[model samples]
Target: MTQIQNPIIPGMAPDPSIIRVGADYYIATSTFHWTPAVQIFHSTDLANWQLVGYALNHGEVDLRGTNTPAGIWAPHLSYDSRTQKYWLAYSHMQNMAGREFNSDSFAVSADSITGPWSKPIYLTSIGFDPALFHDADGKHYAAILEWETRTGYQAPGHIVIAEVDLKNGGIIGDWHRVTTGFTTRGCAEAPQLYKHNGYYYLLIAAGGTGYAHGVEIGRSQTIFGPYEPNPTGEPIITSSPQHLFSLGDPDAGHFEMFNPQSLMQKAGHGSLVHTQTDEWYVAHLMSRPLAGQKKNPLGRETSLQKMHWTADGWLEMADGSNLAKMHVDGLKDVPVHQATTQFDINDDFNNDTYDPRFMTPYRTQDAAWVNTIENPGHLRIHGHNSFFSQVNPAIMATRATSLDYTVQTKLTFHPDHYSETAGVGLYYDSNNWLYARLCQADTEDHTVLRVLQAKLGERIDHLTDEVTVPNDTAEIRLAYHQGTAQVLYRLTDTATWQALGTTLDVAYLSDEGVNGAPGEIGGFTALFNFIGSVDAHQLTSFADFDYYTVKNNLERGTHL
Candidate 1:
């Protein structure tokens, strides 16, 4: 029998909303502030998954000036077999300041999964993480977390359900308040409704998306429920199965629940699907922190666990344990054609178009700034704003999938001014990043390679090992191990790669290390390797990237 690895979809693909249409399985995840929002992955066998396309490729919504962890939230994917149309519901988190948590939810539909989706219909602004449930009798309902800001109420809020009309955005009746949580782990959100055995089951993510995160379930006879908790009154799946003292705490970092023996952490926010063979599985979000460190640089990834319905009509893990596992048994003898055990990326810039895996922050990328046709065998990016700018920056990046990995790129750039620089490095967001770029030296006339660091929005320059490049081309590489990074560069293909600066401790570029406002959680976005250009003087300066590659030392596993 084939064994499936955990994290079916890795690197910042959190809050998985999975469903099956016919014989194919599809999962949609949150993109946060990245453009082409709502990443969708398809799989035949549960072990292997591939990125098919993004649902919001066109300018469906503007993400300009979106803060860290504040754009696209959980996206629910559902197919109405009767109508033969696919529906998607997602939340656009616009603000987090003052704990306002103001968010707008919308719904869009298309005839096909990979599609020209219709314009978004406004759903509600009451909360985030909206999910659409299609009933067997042609009734549609929306379930979401109604964010509560009152002093005495629960910190996050309650899961509410209401009937909604899909054709026109209209709520049928008042929002029905369901149970806050099915267990003591009380930061309940991401409510997904499923009907099985004549019961409407409500699956929710609890434990605040931190060290104690887990998936809890409740069921009721009616759609709007005074739901009953699971018989065990505990999460069905979690990384830390032991009891946690901080049950109702709203803190995002629960250091007490950090299990030293476990490789996976923060396993919660699950969605379930029934296979054609009558086998059941749940896809949930999980995180793998760096070895011995609690900081998660890869953010939350999607993982799968085999589950079964109890004789008493309750959902339980097939293994009879609450703890999530690193390896799971495949569903029967499902044959998969293209399946790999590891994750790596290599792009040669040989095609006229860019890969869908490469993404930009905030605004949609314009062809004038980032294009491949300008340079036949290269990716030409015209520098516009600096990396700190939220408006427009010539940056093309892909998610960093592992802690021990090397990201290398060959760049050809001519920087007439000191502010005009272009190269490759790792980026967390606008306020946190590390870049080794080809820029002009203050004392010299030619271009030189320099290393710059941004920690908590403060810029630091490592000016010790600056190397001057006589030509326009250079190869730069960034190797990250554990929580540290080393930047290296060479002028020519045959030249030895020289270290640009001392090893820098980049553990702070994580979800917990990056400081957030008083009422907001720190960045939950994943680390990215990008080749970007900065032109403070003018937008005419451009950089051509010959190739980019990412190589991970470890196999795709549950730990760093």
Candidate 2:
């Protein structure tokens, strides 16, 4: 048997919705508070997945002023044979303050997976994690969590199913609750409806989204009815399989449920797919925390688990264990194919277009701000708002796919004022990030490079004595290993890299470290290595980046 490693699509890819069409397999994961929302990856072989593009690349949604964990949630991808269109359903979690859990769901369809998708049609404001199910009878349905805010009820509420009119985006009838006591684990959400062997199955993510997260399933004869939980009464796939009922707890940081034996923790929110060959697999989200800590700097990632249908028609892991594994069985006759968009990225900026992996936060990337054709061989990013703005910030970033990684970029910028700066560093959101920038010093006609840090909205200037930059050009590099980051710089092109500041503790960049609101759980998005610019002075300043390179050193043992 061939062994395939877990986390096939690593780093910041979470809440996967997988589907198989012909010989191709695709997985769509959530991208909260990030532009080009709703990440979609393709894989010929299940073991190796490559990001094709995003569904919301067009201006279908505006994430301006969106909170850290309150943008795009679980994006459900499905293809309708009747209409010959691909449908994507997702929730826009607007507010989480005071436990309101306010959300609005929408759906957009396209003829192709990566294409000019249609305008988004508003679905409902019931709750989040909306999934679309097209039945054999050519009718469509949507299942979602009906968020309960009552004083004494199940914390997150019930999984309800509704018949939806896809054309007009309206519900055919009232929502019907289909689950009751499905599993011992509580905080159930992310409902996916499927038809299998004369039964309608509902797969859910139980035990919240933390260490006790797991995949649980139920079945019923009708589309909307009382579904029976799996006979085992346990999650079919999870990192911690021990019994735990956290009904009233909506927090995503159940740190006490951490499983020490498992290398992949918080493995849940799974999407099942039957391959072209006679094989079964589940694409789910898993997290690899820091070695000695419970913080997942890489955030939730996409993993694959080989599954088999029991004789009684229940889904279970092929190994007959509830524990999730770091390595599992692969396809029998399929050869592993290398991913085109691997973890290590080196963009020379020679191409006329920017790398598809590049993404921005809180705002869309347009030719007005970021473009490559203007400079031919360099990516020119015009400054917008400062890093503290939730509206618009000119920053090009990609997901930090490994705990041990180094980011290098050569910046050619001349800041007219201290308020206008440009450089590269790590970012979690607008309120939390680390920036190494080149700006005009207090002295006349002098440029300096300095390091700035933001932790939970508090700013700290780490570099008191800044290094002066000659001709306002320098190469900035950041080496991050196991939650600590070191900023290095070289004045000349061929000069050796020298450390600029002491090692900064950045483990707080993880999901559990940055809190969004007063009562909201920690952030959902992970850390991103970004090349950003800030213009508090004026928006006329632009930064030119010659090249951007990121090398993940996890396999090489954390050597910078």
Candidate 3:
């Protein structure tokens, strides 16, 4: 039988919401702090997925000044058979300070999957991870987590359900408070509603979003009524399925529940789908940490697991175990074919358009700063602000998909001032990045290449390896092996590559290492390889890029 690999969509693709429209299957994942929010992937075989397009690419919302792990969260995708429309529901996490967790939910629709989606219809701000469910009787409903802010109540909140009007964005009735959770593992959120065989199944993510994360299920006869927990009294699927002593603890990372035996951790927030061949699968978020370390630089990725319903109507893994596997049997009797499991971005900047995978942070990309038409053969990036600035910065990046990889770029930059710089390197967020760029020296006589590092708002410069370039053009490469990053550069096409800096420890540029205060989760965005320019003085400097390439060396199931 064919085997489907884990992480069908890798690198920071979390909170998967899967739905089947005719023969094609689509999954939408959360894109926090990244502009063109809510990435949607399409797959027909379930083993392979491809990036189709985005739902919010036309600047329906503002993400400027968004904090780490705060922006568009938990995008839910559904198809309305009655209207023949595709619906997307998501939450805009506006604040996380003091655990106030103020968020607003919105919905959009399109006639086709890759489409001219409608403008966002205002939804409720009651909670995050809101999902829209369309019943067979042509009624619409929204299921969400009513965030509990009071000091003494059940910690994170309750899973509430209410009838809604999709056209006008109004709730028809009062929000019904359902169970906080159906299991011992609390912190319930990401509620999805489905009906199977006259039972309304409510799927939830619990046990936080860390080592103890798992997918729990409950059921009720009516759409809004008392629900019953799973008979096993534990998560239907998890990385660590064994009973935990610290149940109901409101901590994000329950490190004590880290399963020493499992390679995949933090497996939860699942979305289910039934294939055209009558096979079932659950796509959820899972993490693969570096060997012997809990730091997840790749962040929460999307993985798939085969599932089957018992005669008694309880969902369970097909392998009969709750532990997520690295490989599993694919859809039965489906024709197996070679699929593109990984992406190696090699852009020549010759096309008139940019790749869909290229993303900018916080704000809509400015045509004045980045343009491909003016230069024709090169990507012209005019610098705006430094990388730390939340506003406008001329950084164009693609997701870092592997722990062991090489990212190289050919750039021609003319820096007349010391504040102007442009090059390619790795980035986690505005607060953490490492870049090797061409800039003017303090003497203001010649141009030089330098390597700079930022960790949690602290900047460090490697002054010893700075090299004087004869001209304005250079090739820069960032080679990463496990947690160490090395910067190399060559002045001319014929010159051999020379080291620009010492081997820098970059493990601290991960989700766990650069986290926020206590009780708050760290940034879950994936590492990115970016080609950016910075002109803090006049913002007139521009960098012309000939090409950018990323090669992944780590094989599946080996390094991961």
Which candidate has the highest lDDT of all? 2
Candidates 2 and 3 compared by lDDT, better number: 2
Can you write out model 3's per-residue Cα lDDT over 1-560, one digit (the tens) per residue?
Answer: 89887777878789999999887989999989998889999887887788899999988988989886789999999999999999999999999899899999999999999989999998899989999999999999999999988887877888999999998996888999988887888889999999999999999999998888999999999989799998988888899988864444555787777888988889999998888888788999988887788878888998988999989998889987888887878877776553543567788888988777888888777788898887888888998788887778788988877778889988888899999999997888888999899989879988889987888998888777788877889999999877789999887889898887579989877777685556444778878889999998887789999888888875644334
Residue 417 error, candidate 2, Å: 0.7
The C-alpha lDDT values of all candidates are 0.86, 0.87, 0.86
Using TM-score as the measure, the top candidate is 3
RMSD value for candidate 1: 1.8
Segments in model 1 whose C-alpha atoms lie over 4 Å from true places: 245-248, 336-342, 516-521, 555-560
TM-score of 3: 0.98
- Note each model's CA RMSD in angstroms: 1.8, 1.9, 1.4
Q: What is the full ranking by lDDT, best candidate first?
A: 2, 3, 1
What is the model-wide C-alpha lDDT for candidate 2? 0.87
Q: Compared with the true structure, what per-residue lDDT tens digits does model 2 show for residues 44-161?
A: 8887777899999878889999977889999999999888889999999999888898999999999998867889988999999999999989999999999989888877888999
